[model samples]
Target chain A: MTVKELIDSGKFEVVNVGAATDTKITDVFCCDLLSIAMSRGIEGAAWVTVMGNINTLAVLSLTDMSCIVLAEGTNLDQAAKAKAIEQKITVLRTDEPEFKAGLYIHGKLG
Target chain B: MSDTITLKYDVSTDDFTRAGEASSDVKRKLKNMNVNPEAVRKVAIAMYEGEINMVIHANGGVITVTIDPDCITMILADKGPGIPDIAKAMQAGYSTAPDNVRDLGFGAGMGLPNMKKYSDDMKIETELGVGTTVTMKVFLAA
Candidate 1:
């Protein structure tokens, strides 16, 4: 689904829509470990994690992920939020648990 | 892109907020150079891991990236307490980073391994109490 659709679904609140609203998300990857996520992350996927930090945004940018889904109600700190904006990273927020958020995106992808 | 491009960055130990700036800049420059995406990813991940290690363990370091048509070489040199056991440190899930770094979601003992996994070639030269230097290269032809 496109980023706009995910935003419209109300499953996640929009934190930053850096990637165009029409950007397509091909899959979902759930991981909290930054290195593991960087090594294993797939391009065009929506990364689901509770790591709301500047490093997480850096990882997403390096991996070319479509967007970052901050699960479990996690929010980016001030520095991370500023970096996200400056870097133009697409960030989404959800109150659901990490796995649950991944499942939701997975269901939609299928 | 026929001429070699060299970039240098000084990683600061004082802030975790800016840890990945050097790697991020490298990634952007590589992409702009129209380097292979796979190669770019490898260089980015490998260099980023090295950058984080400098911030977490060393008192920061100097990263020099030399990019040519055939390969990208990154040299990360830091003056900090060196790794005592290279063998054990190479193993996955081994980390000496303090608890605070762990809370930052790093220090998982995956840094060196990930750097090795991504780069085409890797080497480490270190001395206890002196420092450590990690050299990694990612070939662009792939």
Candidate 2:
């Protein structure tokens, strides 16, 4: 599913100004641990997490992730958001919990 | 073609944010060299895990990556409180990292196991109070 669809579903809210709507996601991996995500996540997969930090953007950039969805309405701080913008990573916020967001993305893209 | 490249990076324990810089650089180089995706991913993951271990456990270290047509070898050497039990450390879900490290999204105890899963061969050398060095290799498919 597209980022547009995820936003329209009302479960996820797009909080970041620089989120990439043009990218297509092939799969979704849900994890809070950056190292495990780095090891298991396939490139271009959408990552769903509850953590909001600068390292998240760094990890996303290293893995070439398609986008990042912050679960449970979590939002990034200014510095983190600025880094995301600098890195050109798509960042989204969702009201759904980690499990629900995972299920939503999985049902749509799986 | 005699394509071989060796690169070295010094991991900084002072900067948690820059821990994975070396691994990211290696990933970009391997991708630019047009290595196979699977092989590149394996090398990237293994090296990244080692890098994190260096910063979190060892107070930093040095990483050397040697890439040839046939394989990629990564050596991570660090000066820190070495693991007393290599066998125990290798077990999944065993971590000594503090809560602060976990707050930053690591310390899951999956690093060593994940490194082993990604690489063709992995070896560790350690002394309890001295330090630890981990060497891993990923072979390119013929």
The TM-score values for the models, in the order shown, are: 0.96, 0.90
Q: After superposing candidate 1 on the true structure, give the runs of residues whose Cα lies further than 4 Å from its correct spot.
A: none
Cα displacement (angstroms), candidate 2, residue B7, comes to: 0.9
Which candidate number would show the highest DockQ if scored against the true structure?
A: 1
RMSD values, in order shown: 1.2, 2.3
Per-model lDDT: 0.90, 0.83
The candidates' DockQ values read 0.81, 0.59
TM-score of chain B of each: 0.97, 0.97
Q: What is the lDDT of candidate 1?
A: 0.90
Tens digits of per-residue lDDT for model 2, B70-109: 9899999999999998888899889998999898888889
Model 2 bad stretches (over 4 Å): A3-11, A15-21
lDDT for residue B107 in candidate 2, whole number 0-100: 85
| Tens digits of lDDT, candidate 2, A1-44 | 76666666676666664556666777888989887788777677
What is the DockQ score of candidate 2, to 2 decimals? 0.59
Supply candidate 1's per-residue lDDT for B77. Answer: 100
Best by TM-score: 1
Q: Put down candidate 1 lDDT per residue, A1-110, tens digits, no spaces.
A: 98788888987898987756688889999999898988989988999999898889888888888899999899898899998888778899999999999999989986
